[model samples]
Target: MLVLSRRAGESVVIGEDVTITVLEVRGDVIRIGIDAPRSVAVHRAELLEQLETVNREAASPSEDAVQSLSAALRSRPGNHAG
Candidate 1:
């Protein structure tokens, strides 16, 4: 990991589109601001991990199976009428 020292209000550029700036520093926590295009997604590390897990679960074939089962239920006799 690359680490750089930045004071409050200092900023670092990421790639060509994202900027991370130090907004405030308290005793143990530091607040930061990020500027990026709307198309870019930003999340905390833990939240990103959770989102990745959820996305993987959603993209798995089991989810497709579940959807198929739901469709089958809706198509069963007495479940819907033409």
Candidate 2:
């Protein structure tokens, strides 16, 4: 990881399009602004992790859950089979 010291209003450029600028700094919290084209996708790390977890859960369900859902569907009022 490349670490550089930058004060407020200073910017760090990535490649040719992305730019990260420091907007404000308090005692500990620092606010930053990111400038990139609409084509670029930017997301917070934690939110991305949460979305991945949800996707994994949806992709792979437990056997018990599959059985329960099947049973529920079979027991529905209009689901009788001849």
Candidate 3:
């Protein structure tokens, strides 16, 4: 990690388009603002981890579990499109 000291209103730029600016500081808490293009994605670490786990689960489903789900769906009253 590249560590730098910055006061409120100071900013750091990334690449050619992204800028992270310090907005406020109160004792141990600090607030920051990010400026990036609309196509860029910014996510908190924990939320990103949860999204990765969900994506992994979606990509690799168990065969037996899939069959069970298919059976249950087929048995539903209005599900006759099989």
Best by lDDT: 2
- Candidate 1 Cα deviation (angstroms), residue 21: 0.5
lDDT of 3 at 60: 88
What TM-score fits each model? 0.60, 0.80, 0.66
**Ranked candidates (lDDT, high to low):** 2, 3, 1
Residue-level lDDT of model 1, residues 1-82, one tens digit each, is 9999999999999999999999999998999999999999887999989989999987876967989988888899887545
Please tell me which model should have the higher lDDT, number 2 or number 3: 2
Write down the TM-score for model 3. 0.66
**Candidate 2 steric clashes:** 0
**Top model number, TM-score:** 2
lDDT, candidate 3, 1-82, per-residue tens: 9999999999999999999999999999999999999999988899999999999999989999899999998999987685
How much lDDT does candidate 3 score? 0.95
| Per-residue accuracy of model 2 over 1-82 as CA lDDT, tens digit each | 9999999999999999999999999989999999999999999999999999999999999999999999888899988774
Cα lDDT for residue 47, model 2?
100
